[model samples]
Target: MTGRPGGAGTDIGLISLDEAGARAAARVAPVPGVLELPLVEADGRVLAEAVVARVDLPPFANSAVDGYAVRFADLRPGAETRLPVLGRTAAGDPVGTLGRGAWRIFTGAPVPDGADTVVMQEDVTLSGDEVILPSQSRLGANLRRAGEDVARGQEVLPAGRRLRPRDLGLLAALGLERVRVRHRPRVALFSTGDELTEPGRPLKPAAIYDANRAMLRALLARAGADVVDLGILRDEPTDLERHLREAAGACDLIVTSGGVSVGDADHVKAALSACGSLDLWRVAIKPGKPIAIGEAAGTPFIGLPGNPVAVFVGFVFVAWPLLARLAGATAEAPVVFPAKAGFHHRKKAGRREFLRVTLERRDDGAVIARKHPGEGAASLASLAQSDGLVVLAEELEQLEEGSTVPFLPYAGLLG
Candidate 1:
């Protein structure tokens, strides 16, 4: 077990996942700036202000289907009725008002005055200008009301909303060509350990390729933060201290992978203290336990584990949310669905365990979670083979086959 230190501003002992999260959240704040950007450029950005709809969605009440527009009272239920068609109305065009007679209308065509209901063209018999509407019990069923989707002057998107593709389209519909969004927090990234080498380069002796940096870069980018990769640093204290100090001045946050754990070669904790206070939080989570939260010269720093899969899980559980908060976005936890366990396993209590799992449907058509065969913090294949994670809660100690458990798909957690 790694030992905790006092007098360095680091927390003592192993803390629960909730406790670690709360501490991290309390320490890190939203970056202090906003930017006005075009709609296209605002994709994946957090909205700094609520966006109100300038016009109602659809803009006007129109035909929901190609049919005849008439008064609901005019047609008797279960009886045939016939009336002369005044004219035809297509999408984006207006036809003359409907009298006591019927008027032909197409989908998206503005409903003329005096008409309240529409019957599909398929349901009606057409002969020249006369449209025969069969008896229909449903009245005013086909009319899509104006502002049904979104009303004018309504807050279409609240502040702190992370802009998605649909959000962009909605903003465009509101006639907003640009939006005020929070500036993406600039993150400085570095990797530690002499055993680590760049992926493309040849490894020397006991050195292994650095996978943490690349994974972190993608994760940070997907979270909508700008990343400045400082590459891999040797285990030397002087090298680590120099790079971290320089990064502190220019970056809003500093992220280091590998040297977070207690090792003689690890200088990240020392480096953070030299620049700013460092907190090594041993979170109660499987795969990733040692996560460090600190600051270097007013820049927030998050130290992640070196193991590839641990780095992935750590980011998903802690760093990801922290980064989102810094970007002024509301944290969206992964959507979890209850599923039956396909296998049985028991683990030590107290720690929240996340097992990579693939979902399957039984002959009865119920969803079952099949745990991945391999369990290793450094094994990326397990994450690749599995569709999502089976989250064993903090208090759970044993899992039996067919028992319901919460499963989170990769789509929800991964950026």
Candidate 2:
């Protein structure tokens, strides 16, 4: 191991939160393989190539409302002009040329060749076969021009962007059936601890059910990684080293929770050192402090804390960006909004802290972040019940009530 990572009192080689993120991102590169999938299967996949528009959006000018299509010159400036309905057109009907009278056009119908304006049907009264036109209808109103939304040959979606539902709709609108997307990064995941047992089984004395694997599995799926579950590992250095060696050859990245701290039971750092190399970083952040980032037999590895909340925070701040980069996704930080603090908190200097908080909109139209009462590192309920995290910077010694704080919502972090 490069350097030892400890829990408390030992602060030798502790890096900042930003530095930890940068080191993790620098350890892995994007997967080179690409695959072509139909538009229906492309959701949540990163684009390997930019999507160019094959044709102009709404290739033809269409009516924006159910109304009359007429030449702007036909309407009198200060008086109502009556025109006989010459023809009718609905959506998908071939467009026709506008004559002396107005053409009754429905919404989304192609505008007639000689018409420059459309008046809403509700704005004019119909008498016999003629429609009364209002005097003040503006020119080019209620019409969608060709290529208004997107032009042909334009890049609608850039490479490295994760495809969403709306992005799929845009691709379908451009008449594309298949899209080239980067191959999903395969991640080998596991948890280590002698006092852990799987759920659905009776727990022995001094043992707890394994929660990290299940939670991390779901989070990995949400982040677009194809997870290779190695299951729960016992705290044996030989077995751990063997598993890491096998996983390294098959997976693009290997992730484990627990067994990185400087304790008798922690053997991940030593096992990694035996097989390949290890960089044990003590990050200056609350909940998650000692994080192990290294390689196992040449494959990248990340060892997170065993505490559920710490694992969650560590994955979001440290591992998530590395996974995104490996999956060919562009870097996107979670958006944080300013909110008033409904409670007060005090912390030490030289460490960043994240408080689980729920937001409340006060009667005065101000958003307030109320911190969760459970402040333990392993409190899973705090993560479940709260909206997101209220970030307290290292320089902030005390957060007073009613002070402005930066709040990051969980909605912005997940898929």
lDDT of 2 at 309: 94
* TM-score for each predicted model, relative to the true structure: 0.94, 0.96
lDDT of each: 0.84, 0.91
Off by over 4 Å in 1: 1-12
Per-residue lDDT of candidate 2, residues 113-215 (tens digit): 9999999999999999999999889999999999999999999999999999999999999899999999999999999999999999999999999999999
Residues 1-415 of candidate 1 have per-residue lDDT tens digits of 1112232333346788877777777777898888899998888999999998889987878889988888888787789998888877889785468788888888999888888898988898887878888876377768876888899989989999999999999889878999999989999998998898898898899989898898889999999899999998988877788898899899888888988778877778887788788765578788898788877877778888888888888888888888888988898878889999998987666677899999999899899999889888988889879999998876666788889889999888865
Candidate 2 stretches greater than 4 Å from native: 1-12
**Pick by lDDT: which candidate is best?**
2
lDDT of 2 at 214: 94
